[model samples]
Target chain A: QQQVKQSPQSLIVQKGGIPIINCAYENTAFDYFPWYQQFPGKGPALLIAIRPDVSEKKEGRFTISFNKSAKQFSLHIMDSQPGDSATYFCAAKSAGGTSYGKLTFGQGTILTVHP
Target chain B: GAGVSQSPSNKVTEKGKDVELRCDPISGHTALYWYRQSLGQGLEFLIYFQGNSAPDKSGLPSDRFSAERTGGSVSTLTIQRTQQEDSAVYLCASSFRTGGRDEQFFGPGTRLTVL
Candidate 1:
């Protein structure tokens, strides 16, 4: 079973627009959420992350809005640019477990920004 | 400040052949992980190693898949009797520690194609 589910397998947006990708998980034990960005033929890079303790966290143009009760989190890219075009992935990790540090990833979202 | 590095960025082999992929983590990192990313699929966890602890291999798809970390810095994932379904991008990542909050640095994945 997929532990984390993501929606909108592909997204297209004009430059300067905002692109939002959402993810949901059923495991309430997950406390750490992170987003990764990957370019073609490259590995995913850590974009931003958030802890369930806070409702939201923003870094530069990337923002993570997390709802602990709903077991959901979303990534919003403000002033999206053409360079932001890449595959985005949402992942979660349990704080305590034999599987600690093992991240469960969601289906990736391919975001394309048109100039 | 070197990042995680993977070898043989791309590999092509026939079915029933065995293949080995390697990863070199950043200096001094104590945690290493292997993940598989299939086309249009999420990053699937395969194995994890932290310090001298026993590796968590529960995520490995089958006995044909195995990995070893030597000297706590380099890792090699070996696949025996590969099949077409084994075709995917194998990714490696490393972190400073197994802490829930530590960011993972990923290497450019090794794309394996089984024909």
Candidate 2:
């Protein structure tokens, strides 16, 4: 079963636009959600993260809007630039039981910010 | 101080051969993980290690795929009887602790090609 599902296998946005990537999870036990960005030939890097308690969290131009009831979360990149073009992955984890810290990743989305 | 380091950025081997990929995590990080990314596929979890405990090998795709962490610092992924289907980028990541809740630091990854 696909525990996590992501949409828009690929995306393209003009510079300075807002690009949104959506992810949904099926397991209610998951509590932590994180977004990662990866460039070609590089490892995925932490971009932003959110917990269930908050509806939205923001850092700089990156924001994570989480919906607990919907079991969905989305990453928003404001002022998207050419440098923001890369692959994005969303992961979930449930730290409540022995399965704590085992991340279930969503199918990645490739973002292309046209300059 | 340096980020995670992986050896042999790229490798190519013939079918039925064996291959080994190495990963050196950040110093003092106790949790290590291995994942594989095939062409056009999402990151597939392979294995994980925490402290001295036996690894969680649930994600391993087959019996021919195996990984080990030595002294809780470095890890090696072994592919026996390499096949064309085994060609993919193997990624290694580390965190401050296990349970995948902590932010993971990923290496550049080793690209493997089996012909």
Candidate 3:
């Protein structure tokens, strides 16, 4: 079973627009959520992250809105630029267990920003 | 500071052949992880190593897949009898600690193609 589920396998937006990617998870033990960005032929890079303690966290143009009760989180890119075109992935990690700190990733979202 | 790195950025091999992929973690990082990303799919966890503890290999797909971390810094993932379905990008990551709050630094993955 896929632990984290992401929607909209592909997304296209004009420059300066906002692109939102959402993810949902069923495991309540997940205490950390993070987003990663990857370009062609490269590994995914950390984009942004959030903890269940806060409802939202923003870094530069990236924002992570997390709803603990809903078991959902979304990534919003403000003033999206053409350079933001890449694959985005959402991941979760549990605090403890045999799988402690091992990330469970969601299906990736390929985002394209047209200039 | 140097980040995680994987060697043989791309590999092509025939079925039934054996292949080995390597990862060098950032200096002093205590946690290492391996993941596989199939085309247009989410990352599937493969294995994890933390300190001197036995690795968590539960995510390994089959008996043919095995990984080892030597001296707590370098890792090698070996696949015996490669199959076409094994084609994917194998990513490696390292974290400063095993806590859920620590950010993982990823390496440029090794793309393996089994023909």
Candidates 1 and 2, the one with greater lDDT: 1
What is the lDDT of every predicted structure here? 0.94, 0.90, 0.94
What digit string (tens of lDDT, one per residue) describes model 3 on residues B7-75? 999999999999999999999999999999999899999999999999999899999999999999999
Best by DockQ: 1
Clash count of each predicted structure: 0, 2, 0
State the lDDT of candidate 1 residue by residue for A36-88, as single tens digits.
99999999999999999999999999999999888999999999999999999
Cα error, residue B23 of model 3, in Å, equals: 0.5
Cα lDDT of model 3 by residue, A79-105, tens digit: 999999999999999998755879999
Error of 3 at A67 (Å): 0.9
Q: Sort by DockQ, best first.
A: 1, 3, 2
Q: Which whole-number lDDT from 0 to 100 does residue A64 have in model 3?
A: 96
RMSD of every prediction: 0.8, 1.2, 0.8
Kindly report the fnat of each predicted structure, to 2 decimals.
0.93, 0.63, 0.95
Please report the TM-score between candidate 1 and the true structure: 0.98
lDDT of 3 at A39: 94
- What DockQ score does model 3 reach against the true complex? 0.90
Interface RMSD of each: 0.7, 1.7, 0.8
lDDT of 1 by residue, B3-112 (tens): 99999899999999999999999999999999999999989999999999999898999999999999988999999999999999999999999776899999999999
